[model samples]
Target: WNVRKTSNKAIHGVYEGVTIFEAPAKIGLNQQAVGYVPTDEEWRFPNFGEDTAHGREFTQSREGTFGGDNGTKSVLPEHKVWFFYLQRICNHCTYPGCLAACPRKAIYKRQEDGIVLIDQSRCRGYKKCVEQCPYKKPMFRGTTRIS
Candidate 1:
């Protein structure tokens, strides 16, 4: 999950005749923009700056305002804003934290490929694996039982 470039060409990388898709789990934001405004779902690109009322604030404005074009009103103009996207993926360590922290032995590493996996049937929703995972890959999705 090492996606350094912002464009789609950098987001998905092809390796060994296989296309790899990177889904970012963490993002770092910096930079600034000028005269940028948000658009509604109906709005599409190449036709930007339409339907400003249908926009949502990325971060709360500096003055606690909902919509503004300048930095004084909001954090910064939309165009100047920059976000550093980082993708997180399992490293498949020799001794995985999720595998060790699972109380019910629900998590395991495959012998052949060394890929870590979870056995849902053995999981008791303890969430120890989720807490212990350094990369925060083991997420708790709530109970599967129906009442």
Candidate 2:
């Protein structure tokens, strides 16, 4: 279901008994360098049964067409292709590496929800947080020189 169609202000949804929440918008931030970061404009919903090039490659790898007797000549049937969609986001761990890596103490976790956030003003564009975060959630904005 498209949440924007229902309400632009809404940021949460339920799909197949799983609750999904939208990531906060990063206005004026060029997030191309960041790995798989979600924006308010784009929601990373699981697209099941989508026939993508990566899906085709995954199917071939699973069927052993690349290294087995088939070599590279075998093509798996379209109906036999099996792929699952995974939506990645910050796990908000009890011990956040991003928060711990910030020398300026720019990154902090909220006491209530435990949401990790980087204080932009205090951040000196030191990419320690970016390097330490396993999920690669905190991104460095080169234009602003802050992470």
Over 1-147, each residue of candidate 1 has an lDDT whose tens digit, in order, gives: 555646655344644431111111222112122222222221122222334554544334456455555544533334421121122466777556566566676787877778888887888876666566666655454224200
Query: How accurate locally is residue 9 in candidate 2, as Cα lDDT from 0 to 100?
Result: 52
Clashing pairs in 1: 32-80, 32-81, 33-80
Local distance difference test values of all predictions, in order? 0.48, 0.54
lDDT of candidate 2 over 60-130, digit per residue (tens): 34553433334545554443222222223677876676665667879888877888777888999777776
Task: Assess the local accuracy of residue 125 in candidate 1 as a C-alpha lDDT between 0 and 100.
Answer: 71
* Angstrom error at residue 45, model 1: 28
Specify the highest-TM-score model's number: 2
Q: Which candidate leads the pack in lDDT?
A: 2
Lowest lDDT sum, 10 consecutive residues, model 2, at 18-27
Q: In model 1, how large is the Cα lDDT of residue 1? A: 57
Estimate the TM-score of every prediction: 0.38, 0.40
